[model samples]
Target: MRVTVLGTGAMGAGVAQSLLREGHEVTVWNRSPERAAPLGGHGATVATDAATAVERAEVVLLTLFDTDAVVDVLEQAAGDAPTDAVWVQCSTVGVEGTETVVQLAEKYGITLVEAMMLGTKAPAEQGKLTMLAAGPAEVLERIDPVLRAIGAKTVRAGARVGDGTALKLAANAWIASITAATGQSLAVARALGIDPALFLQAIDGTASDSAYAHTKGESMLAGEYSAQFALDGLRKDIGLITDSARATGVSTTLLDALGRVYADASAAGHGSDDIAAVGTAFTKD
Candidate 1:
């Protein structure tokens, strides 16, 4: 399988490396040429532009930051993409933005699959991320092997383009909500003079135990603010959840509240920090 990966960020490079490990011919492109250099030694070609990278690839994986970045690259590659190419959009853009990609791909007669991954950088690199995919059944079938190379599990939400995006937003909402609750609860525990470790241990003993909570709890305890998922990114995902819920006539008060918490964290200058830093927002002065 020939693969072209755009964006070359942590997630993008990780995906490219996964493909290379699978013996696929992978070409990677980043806006800053230097960002793509690290992949060159991995037997992956680095392209100076999106068009050149995507030109001859059978599968194009987009792990861009947001919808705007995705549009910018596609616009630059307008007339150069192979007509029968399969575009796997792995970014977690909102529903409306994903629908636009579907429309544009249809206009170009290309196969577009909405593939939003669950898990962060390490899992992506280890090919253990879970992929939520939706699009034409034929397209999913054609790319099953490629998807399997990067994901340990792939769930087919439905055959609609935005279905995958919706599923991603809902999943992210759960992540944000649980993270916020954990952060707030730990703050209360500290206020009452309970050790954070004991609080985590107590929680881990119950049915409320979850991988998401454990990971965030450990990060919070250690005060690690690395960008596994940046605060601003979670803010964006929460906003998407609110918007999608509203569009579908669903109540989004909890999501809205979580979005505000993240917005506050970003406003306090932690936007680029990992979302686990939300714990700091509840700290005493």
Candidate 2:
């Protein structure tokens, strides 16, 4: 497959490398060119500008920051892409953003596939992401090779363009809740004069145990806040989640509290750190 990946942030870079490993001819571009430089050594062709990136591409992958970035980049690059190119939108842009992307695809006469990926750096690097996809059957089939290179599984959300984004928001709500709950548990343990590691040990093989809890908890315990996924990225997703929840008549009580905790973490200069930094909000005064 001749593929072009735009916005080579952490996840985008991972996706590009995964494609290269599968022997796909991959072209990559990023707003900050340095971020895309590393992939050149991994067999990806680094494009100097967005317009040149997709000139020879059969598939265009988007892993940009949010709605505006997606819109901005595609506006510049989509015109230059091959007319029949299949576009895989891998950003976590919410329901409204997906609508805008759909409109953009329509304007260009391109096939759009909404593929919201699940998992963070490790999964993306290891080619094990779960892809939530929505698109026409023929288009999905056309891009199956590209999807398989970067995803362990492809879950069809629905035929509607925004269905994948909707499903992604719902999944992220659970992730935000569980991550915040883990931070709260670890914080309470330390404040009560108990070793937080012991709290992890107590739940270690119990029905209450979760792999995600231990992963985020260990990072919090060691204060290793380096990002596998940045705190600000999760904060953005939470905002999208709450907006969707409110529009659907769902209660925003838990999401509102989670939002505040994460907002404090971001405000305190941990926005670029991993989400385990949320533990700081609960632990610090």
Candidate 3:
């Protein structure tokens, strides 16, 4: 497949690498040209500009920072984009932003797929991501190989444009809540003069235990917060979830409170750190 990817950040670069490994014709562009540099050695065409990148591909993948970036890049590329091209938007652009992307797709006569990547750097690089996909069946079938190349499993959330983003919100909220609880759990364990590992041991055989608990708990213990999924993106996800809930008159009491913790962590020095660094929020408090 002839593929163009915009925004070669951690996730984007991983996706492009995996696609190239699968022998796809890959073209990539990034706001910071250096991020896309290593991909050039991996058989990808490093595009000079966003529009130049889009002109030659049958599939366009976006993994940008936010909806605004996604919109801005697509607009820049729209002038040269193929009208019948399929755009698999792999960014988690929130509920409202998903709708906006859909409108843009309609306006430009392009097939749009709302694709939500449900893992971080390692999973992305290893092609072990769980993909939440929502879009037309025909377009999905057209790009199933590319989807398979990037994910361990691909689940179709729905046929509507924004359904994948909604599923992404649910998954992200679950992850944030777990990380927050883990922070509190370890903090309480330590303050009470109990080894944090004892808490890990206690939960080890229980249903309440999770892989995330172990992963983030170890990060807490080692004080290693190198980003797999950065705290900033988690903060954004929290805000996105709360806003979406409020839009439908749903209660976001807990999520709203969690949002503040993540926001404060972002305001502190942990924005670029791992999402597990939220453990610092509880420990410091």
Per-residue CA lDDT of model 2 for 202-246, tens digit only, reads 999999999999999999999998899899999999999999889
lDDT of 1: 0.86
| lDDT (tens digit, per residue) of candidate 3 on 1-285 | 899989998899999988888889999999999999899999999999999999988989999989999899978887687877889888887988888888887788777887789999988888889999998888888989889988999999999888899899999999999988988899999999989878888899798889899999889888899999999988988889999999999899999889888887887899999998898888664
List candidate 3 stretches off by more than 4 Å: none
- The pairs that clash in candidate 3 are none
Using TM-score as the yardstick, the better of models 1 and 2 is 2
The residue pairs found clashing in candidate 1 are none
Q: Which ranking of candidates, highest lDDT first? A: 2, 3, 1
What is the full ranking by TM-score, best candidate first? Answer: 2, 3, 1
Quick one: best TM-score, which candidate?
A: 2
lDDT of 1 by residue, 135-208 (tens): 88998999888898889999999998888888898899888988888888888988999887777888776887
In every candidate, how many clashes are there?
Answer: 0, 0, 0
Candidate 1, residue 185: the lDDT equals: 81
Which 10-residue span in candidate 1 carries the lowest summed lDDT?
Answer: 102-111
Candidate with more favorable, higher TM-score: 2 or 3: 2
